[model samples]
Target: MQIEVLVDVKTTLGEGPLWDAQQERLYWIDSFDGRVFRATADGREIRCWDVPQKIGSMAIRKDGRGAVVSLARGFHFLDFQTGDVALIADPEPDKPNNRLNDGKVDRRGRFFAGSMDTMEEGPNGALYRLDPDLTVTRIDDGIIVSNGPCWSPDGRTFYFNDTWSGEIWAYDYDQDRGAVSNRRSFAKVDRSRGGAADGSTVDAEGFLWNALVYDGRLVRYAPDGRVDRIIEMPVKKVTSVMFGGPDLDILYVTSMAKPPLPRFPGDGVLRGSLFAIHGLGIKGVPEPRFGG
Candidate 1:
């Protein structure tokens, strides 16, 4: 299938593709620029919001107000109308070098996010979860760059990717207790493709769609981590993806633009933009909202 450009609002680092089923709109973040964008299914009517800080990700709220967003240091409640952020929790108050990265809410309606070092310096990052009661807890440690926190369709398996580790892991998930156990390597991407494992989503068919940032490809992996298909992209840096539209059939993607001294000359010109794919014959599940 061919991918079409949705919007050309180039971003420094685009990530976090979210689908708000209740509002029937798509939300994603320009992570480095502190911007968030909203668009309709048909790729029309785009709205941009300037967040207070480097916005890593956001989760829909159950109360219908807006999203629970992750910032450089912690979590906040972002007011939908005013673009105001009320502080919630600063997970790593002492780790100034660490910033919030990719995240998503689980089937149990709890927000799970991770933090990573800014310079990709070392394994200083860690994964965490925000309970419905507004409490914060740590999950794992020693992660340089955290990315890809997606789940399986039946809610039995939890998948997480550590870009620095170049591995996607699957764990037995406990929905009621909000826990993950028995970590196993699900997939290992060949970073030689000029990219690292980034944001991803699961399709209704029990397959994983993962973006290879700077590799210009989005790969679909079967439930067993077998490469099912690979879709080439126009730009080098494909950051993240999500399924949207009324039928949850549209696949929305985000990319990153290259800087002045373009590393791969001619590449990344169309980077940092949103792209969409349709008629893929696969559907997506609704993203759970933050129950808190």
Candidate 2:
């Protein structure tokens, strides 16, 4: 397999890579910068939308109007044409120290996102589900830094992780009802191995691929929680991953540039760039759009 830098944008806290198969475009977010980016599969024709607040993640709407996004304050609807942002709901209005983080849509078209404590001090955050009717529901709680939200190929299992905890959890998902239960530890990263689970995506074969930030490793996990493969990345702080390309064979990764965090230090020239992995011989399921 070969890996190439797709975009050298060097984003700060780069995360949430989303591929729109219908439009043949890729979307991503630079969390702290409050920026949303769109580019072609070849990393061409790049466009950016600057929001007023920090954006955690975004999913396209099924009606093809715009996107439903998680801003620092709460969930919002973003209009691509007029660049307008309207508040949908603030699930945690009492927690001023938390912000929404990584999220993904289920096959049934509900958006599931989790919040994180901005100070990284305690588990003052929770996971939420935004339904098609624009209503928000809390799914799980006691999270420190939320990341890596995805689902299995059959839609029966949900995968997510709390970054600082180094544990990735799996849940029994009721796809039709958008409810999750039977949470269990699917995998745990040994931080001593130089990485922590940051973001993840499931392949067509039901394997989980996770980006290990601060360690520069992409790990693929089997359905039984076995480590299937590990690919060393060129840059540390690999924040997130997604599958794109006409055939969904390319693995697109996002990384971070800033190096001030005490736990995750040291920076390199390519620290904040986007990368694409070619010839993986695997395909990804199309990301579901938000039903709302």
Candidate 3:
């Protein structure tokens, strides 16, 4: 059976849904809107924060602030309470056609993020690691569209996706030294089946939940890379997913209300909606903050 929707939030270009355990709130980004939103599980009133530039990805800091990516200004510190933005660090000063994209904090508190070509043809995008000392280092290169970065439950495996290539790669991650090695294929999605895997999340059971962009579905895969379950969505372009709600039984998916597909009918109605799928008893680990 397909996952059912509990509610819908009309969001344009929704991405990066993160659950805050302490606050029990859900946070996400609307890249096209240049905004960050925090809302309850039932899809009630949403608190929106405007960013100076397009925010690529964001995670909650130890201090309860937002560690956000400012497209041209590099990493920025966002005071979620006061809406104050400060500069953190920037990597590609020369490549103005690139900006940070999907990213998450490791269990050890190190933030790992990647950039994408803003020009759509530029290949300067790369993945990076941000240490607690506020230092940024490029970890992987030659990426066109970067996503995922969900770690296995035991913390020994890291999953990353290049959506354009329709391939998800897993690497052996070292917690003590903060290194990733033994990169290999974890999953190869067929673009013809739907779209490539966009943002992804790992459940407590170690199952990888992948948002099938442009396919209007989220697929759960076992460790061996077999499709375990498929959850349908009303909207396509599912940018990201996260486990939220009181028990984490609720799966929150943020999607892009892409412009109407002229040739493809029934495309305009589902664009830019936040969907909730219930009944999955999966609790996502809260994102670790910097220096926590």
Candidate 4:
């Protein structure tokens, strides 16, 4: 399907985009710029918050609060209503180069997030699944840049991406036990595109829609690992995609402009911007917030 830009906010390293069904709003994060953005379906009523460290990812709560992964510390509970913040836990206290990245709640409403290396261009990342009891488990390791942790519609299959290897891996997920096993390569993309699979979300039909960061497009893959469809975007770096809006027919995309060169006029112009597109009317499960 063809992609049409909805709104462009010009974000720097824009990554995670989550749809909060209760509030009918979209929450996203600008990784490098340390900012979080919340907007409505019409692209109106936009609000942005400045975070102290790099804001890696965000998820809404059952009570309309926000939880963020601070790059330097651990998970934090954010008060969208009162602007108060509190730390939850730090799984990797010794690894300062690694920070939390993409994450979302599972079918059981448990938060599953991963960490990435801040210093290197290659692998040094790990995948983590946080239980409701606040126990964090290292599910997958040896990842150079961990990406999506999206689950299939049935909650039996899970998909994750290792960006540096250009492969998206699938797993047999046990929702009741909160476990993932049988790790296998789900899809491998061409390296010439300059970006691997970044953040992604699954639709009701079980198709995994992945945003190809720096490749200027979104790809839909079948459950068996076949490319089903491709949705091209205007921006070169398509950081993330999520199904949002009242009917979930709208696909909210977050993009990042190319970084500026030294002594150039493009310093902050293209780095951070929000974009949206319509036409695909797929309803995604509302992000399972903490204590859901």
* Best candidate according to lDDT: 2
Query: Clashing pairs in model 2?
Result: none
* Model 1, C-alpha of 144: deviation from truth (Å): 0.7
Q: Write the per-residue lDDT of candidate 2 for residues 1-292, one digit (tens) a residue.
A: 9999999888988989999999989999998899889999999999999888988999999976689999999999999888899999999999998999899999989999999999777999899999999889999999998889999999999999998887899999998898999999999786886678998999999999999988899999999998999999998789899999889999999999985367766668988899999999999989999999
What digit string (tens of lDDT, one per residue) describes model 1 on residues 1-292?
7689888888778889898999898998888888888888876788888887888899988976778988998998888888888899999999998999999999889999999888776899999999988899998889988899989999999999888687889999999988989998999897886687989899999899999877888999999999999888888878899998999999999987653225533354577888999778889999999998
- Cα deviation of 218 in candidate 2 (Å)? 0.6
Better model by lDDT: candidate 1 vs candidate 2: 2
TM-score of each: 0.96, 0.98, 0.92, 0.91
Over 4 Å off, model 3: 1-9, 70-72, 259-266
Best by TM-score: 2
lDDT digits (tens) for residues 203-285 of candidate 4: 87888889887677788899888999888676667778888888877777887755422221232343456666666656666
Q: For candidate 3, write residues 182-250 as lDDT tens digits.
A: 989888886785577889988888999999887777889899888898876776677789888878777
Q: How much lDDT does candidate 1 score?
A: 0.87
What's the number of clashes in each of the models?
A: 1, 0, 2, 12
Worst 10 residues of 4 by lDDT: 259-268
Of candidates 4 and 2, the better by lDDT:
2
Q: What is the C-alpha lDDT of each candidate?
A: 0.87, 0.91, 0.78, 0.76
